[model samples]
Target: MTARALATTCAATACAATALSLLLTSCGIIPGLGGGDAPAEDPAPSAAPDAAAAHRELPLTRQGRMFIDGGGDVLLEITFRKLQHNGEYLMIEVDHDLLEPLRASGTSTDRTAPIRLLDPVTGEVLRAIKDPGTGLSLGTYFTEGSDVTPVHQGIPTTFRRYFPAPSHDAGHLTFTGSGLGHVPGLPVEYVDEFTPSPEPNIHDYFNEYAEKTADELPGELFYPEEVPEPGLDASAFRQGIESFVDTAESSTTRSGDRETISLHADRMFDVNADEPTAEAAETIRRTALTLRENPGPGEITVVGHTDGSGSDAHNRELSLRRAEAVRDLLAEELGEDFTLTAEGRGSEEPVAEEGGEDDEQARARNRRVEFVFTVPDTAAGAGGEGLDSAARHVAAPAVFFEDLEPVATAEHGDVELNVYPLVRDGAYLFQMVGFGNSTLSDLEADLGAGEEVAGGPDRVTEGTLGGFRLLEPDGPTRYVVRLVTEDGYEDFADEVLTLSPGDEYLALAVFPAPGPDVASMTLHAGAFGEIPDVPIR
Candidate 1:
């Protein structure tokens, strides 16, 4: 049968036992055989076949436990009724409904299904005799086998069998064993009653839990600190007053000598100086008129400042506004073509220190603005040739290998390769070719030969590749070379090269990349000949 059909069948079987219990309890009838009660033996058989057949076909009831071995390791214990039979076979019916939608007609009654058998003891399979045309079964027989044995003998046997059931099903099982007298050495047969529990929904549980847990927390508050009280210094206060008086006298003299006008006032400007102050406006107009009358290479810078009475942020904004006011006046008078820059130094670099009590006077000095002029270098007599003559020229390139030839030799221990770049007339020539070394001990040990040196074309740049050579020796030997820059370019080579005694070699040098972008470099090396037992250090 299909898996789904088998599962449904098992589910129905499990529910059958419970349904039977309820039904029997409702009818005031006992559903199971009483404990410690034995069935009475039948009288000796009669001679007539009809009488014997009647006796053998009598309805039988049994309760049994079931067991499965290799087929599947599961058990089922059940109680069932051996309903009716034909000839030597017995037909047993379970308490639960074992079939599901057996008839497509969908109107069949829910009834206990029959488990047909051949013989109760011999453990032989029974085949149903059916009409050739109708394909209807006459009766069924039980199969015989040695593997079958009685779960219980003499007394009514408890039948147990394990069957696949739906995921949430529950049930019990029942079957007959060889002790039923039909089969001599057969095992018990089984029946199962299964019922499935309703499936659970997860989302509903989660939402309910979340809502219950969300009802228990508090709020937040914030308060700012108070501003510090202002302090006054008597000595500093006197000094500031004196300084102001001195500045006023100096200003008067400077204004007179330069033929400029000056103004002293209780208030520098109107409440909102965002727009140009009258004096600033007049000054910007006069400056622009003068520039128009005599245009030349000169620039004007408008410096802005603010009082220390306010916070830094507020003072900065006020300073910027004051500078912008002057700029607007100049721009409007000069027709936007004038090259002018404005800067604000809010409460910084103060000319007069305020003593807190003279806050107004301190603010008056800080709030003032001024204009500075810068003449072009040509007019300043510098002629603009600053630092150009003192610059250094680029150095020429030099060949790194000068003392060391294309090929050289060294014994064990220290072999030094002297390398220097070649420079001609201010131009550098010939980048270092290549450098490498081999061990004599390695060759002698591995190839049974002393150290040997090999030179060939560079695989990357196709340039000539060469290195030092050392003959067989007992101890360690090494070779070193330094690369020199070509022309005005900087150059470098591998730091050092060392070779152990015996047979071994090493090649270390900078080479160009395989493709274009010759500016790129890389190092290459290898060991050959026999390596000595000395440590790599």
Candidate 2:
């Protein structure tokens, strides 16, 4: 019969054919069946069904029984969920019936028959199976009776169950195809030979298979498509969002930075009515909004200043009221988010000089409350990156003075004087010198003529000017030497000075003509330095 005809006949009655082939040949229906087909060219053994074609005939999902070449008279029956193309190895699920025929067909005296699964596309023999107990092996064949050999060494077989359930475990059988000189002569190619366990749910098994396939498949197969743009309006929408964030950041004032909004009140309200104006109220609202938007750990100083027109006491009170008004508004609007303090400088620092037509403007300027944000030194250190150069300047060493006094006394010519030793360490010292030119006679009479000051007052010492020694009773406390000049001469005082722990020094108090003929006096402190030139009248 022709190959196609034989294949058709086999397909029509594969089971019956298998049984008939076994029985007829063994019982001699065609004499000398194993030697060769004879008489009228007995169907040339159906050209050993092409393994490639056989594999194509195998179903992807094993819903029905499958027949695979099990070598000689044995055939393998397979039932599989899915067949996997694992590059080098093809994995499949086979039912127990797949092994039954091979196990039964082999006799105690015969050599093992080898069964095989082949890859027709690559012409590769992928895996082999053999049963040692039955002396039966299944794999790629080299010659016609290669499977009939007793020592089926190269064939490898593994058995496992694939279950669809809570636990998805599948059995794997792998055979190295590189050992095969050429492709196998198996009837079924790329056969899935392992059986799946029935205990697992079928749906789960399929789901697992799909998931695995997805993972193993090449990336190009199911990638998502590129999305199209949304048009020019989309750009505008995005820009709007950015603008929102920028505006929010700009409006928000940092906690310790200087506040931009300030408050001012006219002199008429120096005593009271520093109430909030509509504009000021609005400004406060804006400031509060800014502060609330950008919260931080800092304090705002509400400094109130005043023009020099009013008495110091009244001006201080007025400025404080103005500052308090602003503070109250901020507190009401901002709540507990900010730390605020109110202070008044009174007439101490005038924005403009006194005695001028611009007094109104000066008054307007001074009648104001300014807010300065102050970050604590510790906080500033922690947030150094946020601090600007000016903020850093504020923290630099400036000037601060505490105690000042007179140290010694002297008399000369018409000048009887009190000298004060100025002590200082900071950048510069400040002193207000007073000149009272009095006669020496008045000084001598006042002091009983050179009578020394005995055991001077506490923390103060009286010492002789020439000798530069403190009186025996005088100790190491800081002193201010006072000098009083006679009439017609100016009185003088020294800027603050610093005296070391132990140092001896002489300071001279000189008297000269007072007023017109009035002579100036040069006062000196020995080791600590001398006072600068002063005008005496």
Candidate 3:
């Protein structure tokens, strides 16, 4: 607009290629127009902590195989980024499309990075972390049914808290994974300390957008020329739970000649651990009350049983540990007033038709603690009396849930949904939902899992939520949808529901805990309405 500057620009255009054509825009006069040696500013404010902060640095010690969604959908020949640690927490950073072959071209796409850490020596799956982010954008309906959002495929997202470090001295800690890892063993490097130096952050598509203010090149010069093809309406993915209550009984039992109350041992304790979980306290209290109401000090037997899957020795030991746990509870509750005996009978007296099956539900029947009541022969017809209804304990399966009632009902277009905010464990809340589609057209329900659009065709690793974001509330550390495929269960992130007309299906959505102080959170899907006060059991 200035006369003198206009004349100078006109003269420069005459020799544009020599001086001003596509090179002069390199200065900060227009950010991200050219390459530079200057150190870049930190894009994330969270990374800025006081130097005195106790954050420690840790190396991934292995090249992390990059998959599009933890699967080999697109194996990005990527370099393993470094990791920083604080206590059991970890922060990992990876190169974003540093290689020309992996750069984003045509259209911008969204991606969910699924990560897993395995023991170098034994490669056992210790835990699973899910996408803690609700996978719901706060904006428009366009991103609703599709958890995919516009993102520069070439820009690094600095995936935070992929999984917590197992322990402090857990060294030679090999982090191996299957997803998209065409090659075995990511090269591990040992670093003495984590000294983070700011590197040049490649501006992503959004930040690289061209502007008209500088009379710069059109948007295509930076941003992707095309937009991703829209798939399903992702607006139906649930976000968070608002309130919680137990609508279904935790358990149910069948009657026999003798009244036996079987408590699922799995829910009371963690994997292979003997102590009862905090939630199990409620069940123990109820059990004590029922026992107190029984007439006379009848002989009470606490018997622990196990499924036929594990070795006889291992199963027997597990059963005994569980029996001791129950006996301890009784000893604490009744003191010396009651005669209690604890016993372990492994893989014997299974109640399930497939109690020997590896299936969790079938195995659940055998993974139990039974309370057997025997009356004294002195009382008239005492042997004839069986356990009352109160003697049977009720509890829904802890980790696995089935036929949970919908706390709220919702429908979008032809998608009828019944949402079950089933229960909350230490770190995450489990949700089960049923979807029925009655329309003639094929409907896609964005269950908030996987990449909406394909990135590349060359890579495939375990893209499922076998490992993901960690949701550390005030309680226990929980994964978003971290699932180790057992029986019929899989992580929620690895699925995309495609329903033809008159078709129906069920889905699971795992979200981060809203913290203990907050009892409820509203569940939101893309463009559809929100479901509030969805209870947590």
Candidate 4:
């Protein structure tokens, strides 16, 4: 059935608190919703029908499910109410209810989990507003004079938060918060203000006054009045979202119009030497090509970093020499069109932490070279080709697949992986996989743990499915999971957990859609190895 038809069925069934489970169960039939037509041979005998329910995507008015670890089988029912535009801020309202009693009351804090809005057109993630003076988020807080009402089981509690208004005139914004992962296609409504006050509307009073700086506004607006400050516009609070595209040779991070291309130092240098290695030629050539496509203000900054294994002084000097060496090669590639400057940071700005079981792995990641430059806004992803253009997109509503059966399966030890066919949506393609443990004991699968030489920079989080990527069936282009950099680098994907014995979990990963001429691609499933011939529908 079509999404519209599903919506009609949901409306008829009344997506209420009592019918939330029914809505989630019916979602399975919507082509790419969740668990669909089962395969003839069961690869994961422990897998069940509801393994992918946690990653279910639903409309704003409909009730969706969220799986909270250690909450047992009690799924949270989230109903998005509004993405209303206020005077200077955007207000988001949602009603949440716990399916069963677990001796815990839902608090407003759960609704404030790094709320962000995705601009599908510009590939920007809009963040919540914050108080510049106090450096505190301008949303619901559990401090004094605030509502600390506890949300009981089965009780629908309404919560609202304020955010920096979108700078564009888009009709809709994709809303993602805490467990309500990427509720795409949320209609944006313009209103003077929300009436009757949303529950835990701690800072709604800011709406009464005109947009002003902390000092310009009345002292009573703050908890402890201090020196008055100049008022600032909403534009000043805008935080740019960073987009990442990874290749075997280098990784590129695009923030706004600026791009930071990171190449592993190991790939460019031998041991602790400063000279260029044989593999450095390919990476340097790729970087030069990207710079030519998205030329900036004629100046590029090259920075170097190193692991914490060496002494501070030696590491700093070595990193500097390496940076200068790489910068020289890049200058030669770009000729006199760009002026490249080199600097070294040593271990001061390490991307990954040290002193752990994965310390060596983290050190390998930290040892890299970065080329930072600003690209013309028009030049960024201009032709919409290659991996860079494909990285900056979100999944849309497209359903051409007949069955959600696993087209490929890979087994490693007791862990089994079942990958479904790809679902092409707009400029993005969505892929789902079922991870099952055949053992009777509990399984702790860390998909991101890879021992190979680092391919690119990674986010700061651990135990995520960030290692998953897609390879062109017969081409050189590789696509990594789209990173949502609102708070930090988080995968623009959703997941369901398998914490019990004889259980299977389902997860999702989104990537830039390949060209229309391409029909299938190879999936790189971290520990499960590579699954080939995954059809795109």
Q: Give the per-residue lDDT of model 2 (tens digit) for 431-529.
A: 222112253221211211122212211111222222122211111111122221122211111111111112111122211111121112233333323
Best by lDDT: 4
Residue 443 alpha-carbon offset, candidate 1, angstroms: 99
Better of 3 and 4 by TM-score: 4
Better candidate by lDDT, 1 or 3? 3
- State the lDDT of candidate 4 residue by residue for 1-537, as single tens digits: 001101111111111112122222212101122222332332221132221222222223332233333323344565666677655567665555555543232111121124456555455556655456554444434342322222234445454455667666555666544333334556677777544343323234433433433235442221211111224454544555455565545566665667777787877888889998978977687667667766454898999989988899988999999999999888888899888899998889877777767877678778899988786432333223322422333334342121356787888777777788765543456676766778876566656433332434345234445557778744434444445343555555543343334444555556656555567888887778887878876
Task: Write the number of the candidate with greater lDDT, choosing between 2 and 4.
Answer: 4
lDDT (10s digit) by residue, model 3, range 1-537? 001100011111111111010010010000011111222232122121123322112322111212121111122222245544333333333432211222222111122222343322221222222222433212111112332222223333232222344332233222212222111122223344333434323224223432222234232221111111224222122111111111011222211123355677777777767788886676666666666654554667888888778788887888888888888887787668787888888887765545224356666655778777643211112111222223221111122111234577877777776655534432234444456666766666543323211111111123332222222222222233323333323343333324444433434345433333445455543233556656555
Per-prediction TM-score, please? 0.21, 0.22, 0.27, 0.58
RMSD of each: 46.2, 46.9, 23.0, 12.3
Cα lDDT, model 2, residue 137: 22
In order, what lDDT does every prediction score? 0.25, 0.28, 0.37, 0.53
> Cα lDDT of model 4 overall?
0.53
Q: How high is the lDDT of residue 483 in model 1?
A: 23
Error of 1 at 186 (Å): 99
Candidate 1 off by > 4 Å: 1-268, 277-280, 287-297, 356-359, 376-537
